[model samples]
Target: MSAHPENRAGLWVALASFVLWGLMPLYWHLLKVVPSLQIVAHRVIWSTLLVVAWLLWKQGRGWLRAALAQPRAAWMLALSGALIGFNWSLYIWAVNAGHVVESSLGYFINPLLNVVLGVAFLHERLRRAQWIAVALATAGVIWLTVQFGQPPWIAICLALSFALYGLLRKLVAIDAVGGLGVESVYLFLPALAVMVWGEAQGAGGFLPLGGAPGWGLGVDLLLVFGGALTALPLIGFAFAVRRVPLSVVGLLQYIAPTLQFLTGVFVFHEAFDRDRLIGFVFIWIGLAIFAIDGALRARRTGVTPVAAASEA
Candidate 1:
């Protein structure tokens, strides 16, 4: 069957967002010379500027006032902001530290972890297939830990943090962009402080100043653009969600991590030995089961999955 024009456009937008997210490691890799903390701080600072400017243009200054009017919402968003900030910091650090492959695994595990969180915190019941999927993914982590003599803590932390962030966002009443703007406001001062401290301490990477050998103009441009990059995909996701079916969006979510995994192996030349492959295979099978079950359930019920688009 032919899809409507809006639906088609939504699909394309969603793909673009996921592709951008999938290829984000390359962008971060370009800033590998900068400290991860600085990169993240810049991200926060510039993202706040861009997002706040956008909000002003789109909805006016009243949006922020309205958001802050609700004290509970403000506090919840503050907590969610911290979680996403930590996720961003860890992800950038992982990419530069030769752990891109492990980082990708975290995102691959994220959806499943979301399901588990729903069950644990929301008191939602999981379907049999979901239980199997979670069990298999758990086994995969265990296998990876036993084989490597250490857990894939990078991946685990990423998945857990993002899942919790998603959970908090779900509870908040504000729209995604508004919530993000609030979070950015919460983070703006701290991030700016970090940037100032780095420069004062002669460790900044933005410009040739304070005795630090700066990365040059190209790096500076990338850092400035990082804010737009962070917000663009989110805007795209928001647009796409209104037009696309939730089930399809859920399926499309895999694109980003899959691309990240490929980038890790092909671009960065990260090692993926047989031992790691076995563990990933288990997770893959679990994810396949989870996707298939969700699809079948949606089809049978004549309803789409009711999930909020995550900012992770």
Candidate 2:
């Protein structure tokens, strides 16, 4: 079927979002000297300010007031805020700590994890192909765990946290940007506390602390600007999802992880031995099955697989 002109535009926007997400490892790597937790704290603070301001400008004060008045949505966003905050912190830490490949694996597996969550918690039925795909992914994880002599905890944490966050957001009534704004607001206080503590302890990077290197204006600007950087892709995602087919967006979601995987292997030169390749191959096969299943189902239903829109 041919896409509408607006949807074609949305396809580009969606691709842009994924590309930015894919290239994010390089951005985080630039601030490798900063502590991940501090980076996350700044992310929370700046994102809250930027999103809130955008909400004010685009939607006006009434939008924020109305959203804040919805107690259930507020509570839901609070939980989601925690999940996303944890996910961001871990992802940043993983990239900076030279675990970019594992982090990429986490995001690559996130969609499958979302499927598992849907079946387990939402009581959704899974087709045979989906079951096979899940099994393959599970085997891949097992292989990686055995190969490494431990589970891929970084990937698991990133996948589960993000999956749970998407699930909660699905249950909420707010629009994407508004929901994120609420989440940022919910997380603001704790993020502020962390930043304050970091400064007090001389560990903060954005702001010069007593014992730390004096802050360069460049570093401070980058730290504060992390807010806009965080919000932009999400804003693009919000725009694209509303305009295009979810299946299209789902296919595009892989772009980010692909970039991350390449960055880890080619750019960062992290270890990629034969055993790790075998494990990733299993995952690649599983993802192929999953994508085929989705395409078939989308064709049959004349609608995109609802589950495929789980990207967050």
Candidate 3:
């Protein structure tokens, strides 16, 4: 409500990001004909191409050379690509494994992990409320682990991978689409390799996308859409980055995961027992404290709302 046009754009981008991510289960579901690995490979390959096209369109022919001229920059972006690839592959794998709900938990916990990352990587001092929030959330997760008598691996991996990915993205100043495009090149080779290998071994690539091998029209569409779908939120997020602050972006990271949680539980019918419930409660409390405290501090200091863009 307090958003300016620019700020509103950022919020819209964040919203778009969450909406697309929340609805991804439906997207992936349509791709049942595609192997998870193949689908992910396509995601890498095609998204790279799309990013490249966008970059070339925006900057003309010199973008790649300029980026490569700064090998350090190129490597950083390439590393970011790898990190995101891990994240994308893990997410696709998790979703296909009937672990979207658990993946939701991972994303929900990601904000807290971001906070931890900030403390570790950025030397940010936590407010008392923020500290309490972290403690509560930690307790909740510990309780869940104890309840399960095993690590919440799916949830933990998702949270950690994303947290690290966000950290890497922050180290650069590239536009989201451009940055992703650059990074896509890093994963392009591996993705292509996988596709070639799949076809060679007769593991069935994009061709068998339906009944027996292929996933069908819907799946093929999804694979293509995946590239566009990825590009959209990223552009939105890039808009937000210019409009917002890092701390604010951190607060906004909750949106996508929150939707994922609901989709996982009520819509997808994932089980949530007493411990898991309690864990979520603590996490919610932690996030609330963290957000409110950060907002107030940032407001006093006239910091922009950057947390929302942290997802990049």
lDDT scores for all predictions? Answer: 0.90, 0.87, 0.76
Q: TM-scores of the models, in the given order?
A: 0.96, 0.94, 0.89
Best candidate, lDDT: 1
lDDT of 3 by residue, 19-40 (tens): 7877787677667656788888
What lDDT is obtained when candidate 2 is compared to the true structure? 0.87
lDDT (tens digit, per residue) of candidate 1 on 1-312? 017888789889989999999999999999988999999999999999998999999999798899878758978998999999999999999999999999999999999999998998999999999999999999999999999999999999999999999999888777778889999999999999999899889789677655677879999999999999998899888888777776788799999999999999999999999999999999999999999998787677665313423322
Instruction: Kindly report which residue pairs in candidate 1 clash with one another.
Output: none
C-alpha RMSD of each candidate structure in angstroms:
2.0, 2.3, 2.9
Q: Candidate 3 overall Cα lDDT vs. reference?
A: 0.76
Which of candidates 1 and 2 reaches a greater TM-score?
1
Candidate 2's residue-wise lDDT over 1-312, tens digit each? Answer: 226787688788889999999999998898877789989999999999999999999988798678867757877888999999999999999999999999999998999999999998889999898888889889999999997899999999999999999899877767789999989988999999999889888887555754577467787888888888899999998887876666677678889999999999999999999999998888888888998787676667666323334433
Candidate 1 local lDDT, residue 4:
85
